[model samples]
Target chain A: MRHLASILLVLLLTIPSSPIFSQGRVLEKKQVALWFGIRDITRDSLANTGDLDFLNYLHSSDDMSEYQYLGVSAHLWFRGNWEADIKVAMYDDFAPNNLNIKAIWLPMKNLGFTAGIYTYPQLMNEFNMFHRLTDVGFFGDTDSNFRQRRVQESGLTAGLMIPFSYRWLHATAYINGGVSTLSPFTEKVTQKMINGNFKREIRYSTSHSPALFFFPEVELGADCFTFGNAMAGIRVRASWYTVNRSVDYGRVTYEWTYANPARNEVDNPAHHFSKFEFDAGFYLTW
Target chain B: MRISTDRTTRITVLISLAFLLKAVSSCIQPVFDFDFDFNKITVTNLDNSDVYVMRNDRDTMYSSAIAFEVTLSDEEFLAAGSLPKAETAFPGFTPATAMSPESLYHPRHHITALRIVTLEEMSPAIPAGSDVTGLFVAYVPRYSEGFLYIITDELLTMINRDFYPGEPSVSFQLFCNQDITASRVLFAITVTLSDESMLTAQTGIVNLLRAR
Candidate 1:
């Protein structure tokens, strides 16, 4: 999975060197640039979350987590106030974080509008492996031979962005809403064993995409060695998402018995969340 | 004009490459591997008593050769384990119903034929005519969306419903009638099961005129 993401990153990097944005080149209007950056992300769920936890059925592992700095690799392209970008985020042994590909149109000065498609991984494994606690003894790992991967939560996002410029200080305040495609899936797998043989599997899903999200953001810095074509900057962003419901997936487990349980018969509980995201980033663009 | 066309071509190529990369990445995890080991069938005609008798009214026949038992136990990667030990066989099995007749596309499994022949005839499925006779039976199971297959007769009877080669080991007798002639006859049974398992066994010449 890591190799797959790495290949995608390579393909995105190829865009800036492409000749499409080259011929009619001007410093501010027609230019090609690569923006690569390091980012740190932290999020808190804001909801009257229930006594239900999806972690009780997953295997234990010490090397997995929900957040990582610069976990998502993104690419942005711009031409005459119109831009297109894609971001694919993956972690937890390269399983999945989420993926977003969108376009932006700046119809007037200081303001821009955007729309795009996005997909998040199944929240069951996302919760268990990334967020759910696995070190809690028997609850963490039900079976050692068990493993699972959920595909995605996919949808469309629309938002507006307002940018302010003051010499070397820049800031963008943006808000967005998402509506998802109705997705439901099920999985069953058989495992071969030493002393015993049994079949195992997990699944079932439904999700609510974000309705609205925004937080103040600011960037500060200047052109260091390169004057017209290059600049370096640092940015701090805080974001909040309105309460949304996601029933991404439910308890994935081992041998329900020697007998294979009915597939897609189990349903996950609804998770309502208002999320918070804080990011600190450093970037170089030319 | 030339430069603009070059730029357009480059843009198209870049976009295509990006999508292609995305496609290749998301398709990494594989699901549902149907892995089952090839199996073998063990035939036992306990005690090698290979003879059958034809008596009018009095008792003249007591033979073990006429009955053969076929057993199929899964090959497990365990050292020493108790017999029928789940201690915990867990006692039940599930069968899946095929949308259509499994025989339409399913593999063949059953006792091909049980033939009785003279010493001069070959040991295979040579048909029985005025003098040569054999039992040929074949049926494809209706349900093979296989689930836990426990090797027990009671469960098998429910799941297979008259399917041949019913259990791990089932006994079958081979005798025509009381009015039959007495001669040395050889017994042969050819079987084929799931996972491409095949078994063909033939007993040596045995006296059928009277039980020894």
Candidate 2:
């Protein structure tokens, strides 16, 4: 993945001068046009309301926090009809464990249809240290100590992008099939008092192998306000559920893990993602 | 003027980027390592019953069993503690489950051995004297031994290794004589680690009433 990313970076730097997209309309004002689109999400990160079993399981931990992203987009100074575009999203707080980059081409301006390659890093919580945190009362002594390292299970994204921008407005429609990984939360234990001794009857733990978190979704982005080099608007994304069905993979069942037992398995009937979310944001270019 | 405006915009962008980088760096924290002790015990009441009844379930059967479940820590367990209803190690853990058994927490390194002493606290309201002393024996009942606690070494390590969930109760009942109409019996388990090294605990007196 590191080599692939390095190659992509080299390609991004050389794409503007490359013969492939070096063809475009010669502008009357300037022979070149270089603009950058920036979107900052750290200002606000509304939580992903305990939708997936994984997110809900993390709500009880002390290490839980909101993750942020700073997205950047660069449009090349290619001539008249052809242009090279690179979009990158850098994720928060950590050094640089997460990223989303897409390099696209627009054959022509207004009413243009484009294709792009997408890549993003994924994270997984194996939950190996959950028991230690839950059993902190053995000596009437409790410790607020808990921590876990996340595992990355990222995969590339494949999709079709239809971008249409007129005089003062811009919109893009996307139908993307992205791959991810999911390990539904699972653990079961029965406690008994044998001759006054508190003993545990551990019947289950999160032993099931993670299932693929692959889903197809439609996303639409539109910019309503456009000033000289910046545009502010809201984006909407619609997608089906993505949790692995109980029948397919064993259901995630437990107490003290979640509030509702009925929410043990939030699997969707149709093969889709467990998230049906709506994200509204901006696309500023300068 | 145009060049000046561009220069100012560039400066603002640089400052913003630097601040964002600072925030990200500050957020980076090393994973915490916790020192945890795993010695624990858990108790369960099968049917949530406070009173256990002697099951004749058969004509020749004079045997009985304790409804309460006392399990020692195997892999996951909460040790005996004085926790209020509002406070809990985990959710759904009530005071009934948090309170240690009779003398399970017998401070001062506890006892070298555990001895199960059975005695009748209350007897049925009758006119003549009733024999309630040796009605039943308090032992760690075993299915392999036809549900009877055979006299043997009562070491803390041995009890911890044996008593757990799904297995028969270490606090088991045997031969509830047909004569005893009603009585409150205390099957007390006494213990602490054989060697007062690190772990030490004493059993509390458990009150079980017999109902034919």
Candidate maximizing DockQ: 1
Weakest 10 consecutive residues of candidate 2 chain A by summed lDDT: A27-36
Q: Categorize the docking of model 2.
A: incorrect
- Alpha carbon lDDT at B144, candidate 2: 22
Per-prediction DockQ, in order?
A: 0.02, 0.02
Q: Give the local distance difference test score of model 2.
A: 0.35
TM-score winner among the candidates?
Answer: 1
> Candidate 1's residue-wise lDDT over A184-228, tens digit each?
544333332211112233333333323333322333334334456
Provide the TM-score for each candidate, comma-separated.
0.43, 0.34
Tell me the tens digit of each residue's lDDT in model 1 across B1-212.
35456788999999999786665544332221111221444444322221111212322222312323343333331122212211222323312235322211111343333333334332244323223433211111234333222222222333322332212223332322222234444555444454345665554544443332
In order, what fnat does every candidate score?
Answer: 0.02, 0.00
- Model 2 Cα lDDT, one tens digit per residue, B49-127: 1122232222121113333333333232132232222322332222233533321211222224433344433344522
